[model samples]
Target: MDLKNKILQTPTGKKLLSEYQLNLLTKNNIETLLDFHDAENQKLNKLLAIKLESVLEIKKELDMLPWQSETFVETVNELDFGTGIEELDKFLDSIAQPFRRGRVWEVCGQTGVGKTQLMYTLALNFVWKHKLQVLFIDTKQDFSTKRIQDMLLERKVDQETSEKAMADIHVVEVLTSEELIEVLKAFDQQMTDDVQAALKTKVVVVDSLAACFVDHRGREMRRTRDSLLTEVACRVRKLAVRGVAFVIGNISFSQDSGTF
Candidate 1:
């Protein structure tokens, strides 16, 4: 009901200012100023005219708001998404592992740097340890039965564990980012609506977030693609806010290593 809550409802970047910013606009009608700046493509004058009288009624110059605490630390500490892989217990302890629920996670890295391996490991934790349901959105069409078999084999766990892992894990293949987005939007709502759903979803891993978002959008600055990625970021933030764990993958290459 308050400004802070409303601001939190919007994406972070979109919330560019505290009350301090209110001082810079032409008038003191804060609502009019916000509507103007946040307007996607609307005309400023027409938008402002409605509040012109309200602005004129204001007498005092807007005082800058008190400096608020940086939410980064709070958000990160609260960002409980990835599962705690027991085998990687030492590694898990080293990282700031946040207890997660169902969310979109974008795990990124350079190629051959353990993106896929980490995801499989995390998936195992979700099912075997946490007793959570994980819907793996496989866009690459690269999931191999052998890989799953091998992971369980290397761990030397029994067939019961392997079968249960495979049975509990749900996989869906999407051809593109647009398709992935649509499916995610649909699946999330469906999962929420299902009654007494045996599913206890803790995370959503996109294995490699880059593959689904390969199309370049602009020639001038090559920033177009990242612009599109903002939508995904919004979803990630929303999910995290709702306590879902998300593990997204990335493959970055470095010439020094000669591969990624």
Candidate 2:
């Protein structure tokens, strides 16, 4: 494939460059963009690489991804995963109108901001009110059953309902990224007939996805982290397409980078 065409085939190059930027590179001839893309000249590759990087970064910053375009139906059938905070739930509804199913949600904040608490609330609501199954994946295996039970009691939910609600949630603890990847890969097949029959699983929660990477640092580790995240994103997208909601938890130490 020609350079421009090849770039277009990849997610990084799937967006159209601004006409002004293209004009700068091609002198108003769109074909010149292709020429620059396919050029064998050493100097041209260096120049093209710089320009391409800039354009790709621009695309990413703008969220103008090829897969993100509104070329297909944009309406989403949603399910309410209420955080149990009335005002917060209202705010979330205004933002996404019930947090559409099959999409991934990331909850993050500093240590005391109730990120895990909100997750617990969401899981309980999904189970008790919605009568749906929730798969809770914990990296630290510290998810509190007692807390959920307390919340249930506070809400005046009967003991039978509380027991059933707790029963509907499945828990898995993984200490490594490899184990997390393996579980995600086999997720579809693991949704057995019995699992499918009791309650159609509506949510999967990963409490603190960042926990798996807490031990790693440096460039190579960062690359591995990014790759694993990409794989997770792909798998999550597939699950979402099949109508499962994914809720992810992340931790942040600074105000600028923490909350989602």
lDDT of 1 by residue, 15-59 (tens): 443444433333534343223223322132243332322222221
- Quantify all predictions' global Cα lDDT against the true fold: 0.53, 0.63
Give the C-alpha miss distance for residue 121 in model 1, angstroms: 1.2
> In lDDT terms, which candidate is top?
2
For TM-score, the strongest prediction is 2
> RMSD, each candidate, Å?
9.4, 9.0
**Off by more than 4 A, model 2:** 1-84, 191-199, 255-260
Off by over 4 Å in 1: 2-88, 91-99, 102-106, 156-160, 195-199, 217-224, 255-260
Q: Relative to the unseen true structure, what is the C-alpha lDDT of residue 163 in candidate 2, on a scale of 0 to 100?
A: 86
Residue-by-residue lDDT tens digits, candidate 2, 28-57: 242432234223233432444445334434
Q: Positional deviation of 253 in candidate 1, in angstroms? A: 4.0
